[model samples]
Target: MVRRRLFSVNDHFYQGKPRYFIAECSNYSCFCVHVEGVQNTSCRSYLLFFVSKQRRLFKFIQPRTQLVATQCGVVKRIFFSTGELSGDLQGSILIRALTREALSRNVVVKVRRYISRVVVKSQKTFQLYGLGGSLMKQEGLELLQDTSKISSIGLIEAVPHLWASWSMIQNAIERVIEDPPDIAILIDYVGPNLQLASKLRKIFPGLPIVYYIAPQEWVWGYANQKVPFLLRYVESIGEICDKVYSIFPAEHAYYQRHQIASEYVGHPLFSSDWKKGNETNQKRARESLQLALDAVVIALVPASREQEIRYILPIMAQAAKHIQDQLVDEDVVFIVPCSRDDFRAKIQQQLTRSGVSQFRIYDKTSSSIVIAAANLCIMKSGTVNLEAVAMQVPQLVLYRLSNWSAWLGRNVLGLQIPFIASPNCVEMRLVVPELVQENATAENVSKAALNLLRTKHEQQRMLTDYERIAKVLHCPEGTSRAAKSMFELMQTD
Candidate 1:
């Protein structure tokens, strides 16, 4: 009987030349010998092996030996599930953090489509792929699908895209099964992610799954009537995920109460240098927009989602008209920060149709600049609220769901929450005025915006609240900490 052994050549370059390795196998032992500066005639290399048995040496040559690096190190495929523009941004940041942390741990990260082969000192390679947007792709995520454009908020709003979403989920599951990931990271966009997690848990029982920026069931779970649903949600997450990284202190506590393996990693917004801006930066931003430094700029952020743009932009436009009518003497300019380039035409039409003349539309790239330059913001109740807070811009949060969806949520689902805006939720108080559902009328929103703009005391009070909230959410290198935790989880036996 004869024994056979195979060895992989490490794909590396030595002094600007490719290196190869040959394996020598005997009847009882096998070892690899490195050959430097070997020029391969073709992709395949032949290795001659000698076996010693009973003090006799036998010579053999292996044919068609492929110069591949499979046995060089461990290859960890990580799948990331994220949705919406905010999730895309967060996912990008987290991806960067993960890459950095991996490098620190002597692991190399390679994007399948962009990177063919990477030669590094690390023996481990992390291949990242999954559902995200262009921003995540830019951060080197081999995207399975793009969910940014299709994300919807309310139940009624999501109904139209249900079939497409289901199809996407099915396709994702099929792909994931075909090329299984060693770890899965689920960001926000709770609906499909929860479903995906449940399916993955059933399919791959031992797979390490993580939930980052988990659902806000804790906030809605405050209602006694909603506790059952919240419990189910918590249990589903707890059962599916190996770890849950919470961005908020309250979120961490809530998960812990439910006995979910969780850690508070703080908000990812604070991980970057764009957390807050000073007056000088504000002035510079205004100047960049060709606006006078003293001009009172009111930013209208209707959100990035298509349903949100449809339901909220018109009302925000109408509110801008009302605000313009009230601030006739002051140099107040209304600017709509388009979160997506495709949404610009819709926003323009809505603003124009609303008869607002002194308004400008900025592309997604200029959103932060517009926020920094703004005196106040009239926006939807979402992650942008926290962004406005970071910029120290007093804002009036407005959200309008479909009438049917709102009714169902209030009457059937019994959804109750103290605050809709993240800043308010973080502070556990009314940091910014929230006009939600029926209350988010043009007149009400404009009135609130005018009050914030005219009343210095109110603006100062909100600014103070924002400072406190920022302090609470500010954890240095928060995303990095989360990546470190996730990497450690990936290393568990």
Candidate 2:
């Protein structure tokens, strides 16, 4: 006897309406039947059952497994947590990479806002949502909270935002528990990210947590007393994260020594998105800024944080004035690329007060173009240092903090490192001149900038070092590699 059974195999939305697919199974065969007019609730069950107890005979149904998986909403949901402007930039790139990788795997991805009921409509395979800023949002990251403006560097600088930061952490924990992700990616922004990792591990013990651009705890063990602190930090990371992707080779080795699951993916700055600067780019950048081809351009990149601006921009302005005095015979123009829109008025006021002439401030311009057009970049010691290296632009890196914060970091935290600039750190030597803390004065900055401008040998030596740094960070399509690794991790489970 040929018995028949109807199985509601697939139920999903088409356009704005519900669509269902029914699989009719007999003792001899099984076939799918499209039922657009049927309501999802009208189906008795979603499961497929065999009345003949001859499931091995249903070989044709094996090919439909992929379709069933897709229709059943079996997607890898990735949660990304990042903060600060730099984090936002990195997160945005990673998000795009993730989307592209998913599409290549024949998956559909969707982004859903953390707080809003509305979901971002798309035809991708992964569901991405987390904490980020406008840039990440633009790349289809459903931001839980916008954290681009809530950044601080030092212990003292973070005091005012402590309460708000704590509240954000609590909210993040609550949301994750509500709809736990298949995988969680935590970018830089150490404190909050580390906290989130620890909490998520306890709440969802099996959830895979990956850390990208991890904190530089390995570089902080200058004193013997700090070794324990460094060990503790690395241990916490190992305990919390299932995988850690390091941008620096030395950092990757450090994590490996401590028995952490880590891989060196190189820096995202060296990814395909940013091409190495050449004469063509330099000429175009100069033209875009309306500068003469023969004119010497000095680019100034201050810190992205407000506190950093207060401690650093004024000194940078004064340094620009000093350079102008020394280069009276040369047609020199200073370009200050504002990192944030809100910082423009303050930067303008500081430059005006310093009596610096023949200078222009660009608010909405790409820093890459500014660096490419520059003969020398006087900037803070951060991600921008790596950018300058990528562009082969000679730079003088400087950084400053409030007196109390500086003292606390040096004395209380016992924070000591050989190099602050990213290029020097990667090279394990001072490839670029760094004027930090009290040494970061107008005279020191101007003197260093002028030396690089006047001495071709020194500039060429720096360029050579940049080439070496590039080799160290030479993983092609690094962000895509990172995304592929993430997908592999998801498949493992």
Candidate 3:
């Protein structure tokens, strides 16, 4: 037989046809190729098979397993949890924003959950934790923590001290390091999150931790009680995290001055266009109040929380009463968006006590309905101020802090801008009037409302300025932008 070479093109054949034979090697079921042109092809094949098996069989053969030190990504994790603010609405919205970001990158995000019993409006109730699950499940991401257990602040705190917890965190670190995330963001809460970051650092020193809207370090001068502990924990965070996003620009500047690397992503609220209640919806709300479409409707948002309702709502109710009598055929209504039915009841009780039942307090309608129906708004300053500006509803911003914060604002920070609304801040002028601290009273609020409602040109100018601010803030489809940024950060060395 000619026995033509099984493989083509060989340089070292001494014979006419380079014939090869296959032999089954002894005691084990091993196969060998005999190359006529090459010496001891069986030995070479054996060595080759040995290496292939090693590569296939060994778990630590991957380059990532060889060096844990070079991995540069988020390490250790902590979360801030405060008992007061029910982050449900904010967390729900944020998870939705993050979902779109994760989907485009082809990455599966896993989140855990827990639940806690909290006092809402002085009534005990259980609120869900793990806002990410519902949104994550919709996008087909893997989830870890029990939504019921992860939400409980007390349970998370019991870890390490009361329960065997390091294993869980270590496993999470392993997964993260395997495919390091572009960024690890810790939002809002200062207590638990700071500790979590510190723990992760011990496991993976190279990981970066970004603190979003960090605790009030500037407010306490970086040396006060919890401030020092936070400062130390954040030092490791600064070492690991490439960026820290702050809620207030001034807060960012403060971190910079203190030598922490930080940036201002601007408030996430600014990125949203607070929906102006639909035209039909606004019309329906206006009709319900029995006001002419031409007759200006003003929105009054007092503090919605029970304590706020007790102290601030009556004042606003009084202001509404004042405006109700003066503007004939004009509509003024108190629109209080409540988280629960009980909150609505609490607000109604206050309305009765104040003798302002003539003014309707809306608990069920959309906030945009209130904002769009009204030409002007009177609201307590916080997130609402930003919303008013977004909707182009000219507003009067108001706030009253405890004496200490007020004193710090006056003697220490000396922030140039007094009015908290974004339109006013961007314009560097009082487009909206702010009655803060001692000034947040019914009489002052009413007087300010009169000035704004009566002056047509002033209202128009404020609206124009607000429109400009809105243009400045309308971030281009933040999900894609944020996703791109996140992906790019992950790919970095």
Q: Candidate 2 lDDT, tens digit per residue, 124-167?
A: 45667889888789888778899877789887898888887889
Q: Report the lDDT tens digits of candidate 3 across residue range 100-186.
A: 443333221111112321111101111112112333333333333312123222222234232323443455455544433323555
The TM-scores of all predictions, comma-separated, are 0.81, 0.81, 0.58
Model 1, span 1-493: residue lDDT tens: 0111122122222223232222222342222233444456333343433335453535433443333333323455689998998998789879888887776764322111122332323333567899999878987899989998878876688898888788888999988876667678999988889988899888777678899989887775443335535325787887788889998888888899889888887887766623432223688889888988888789999978888887898899999999888878888888878888888888888889998988899887677788888988888888888878777888889888889988877777666767888987887777789998889999999888888887999999988988888888888888888888776655521
Of candidates 3 and 2, the better by TM-score: 2
Order of candidates by lDDT, top first? 1, 2, 3
Off by over 4 Å in 3: 1-91, 107-184, 189-208, 213-241, 246-296, 304-307, 328-331, 339-341, 363-365, 402-419, 487-493
Which parts of model 2 have CA positions greater than 4 angstroms off? 1-67, 70-73, 108-122, 221-232, 276-280
**Which 10-residue window in model 1 sums to the lowest lDDT?**
1-10
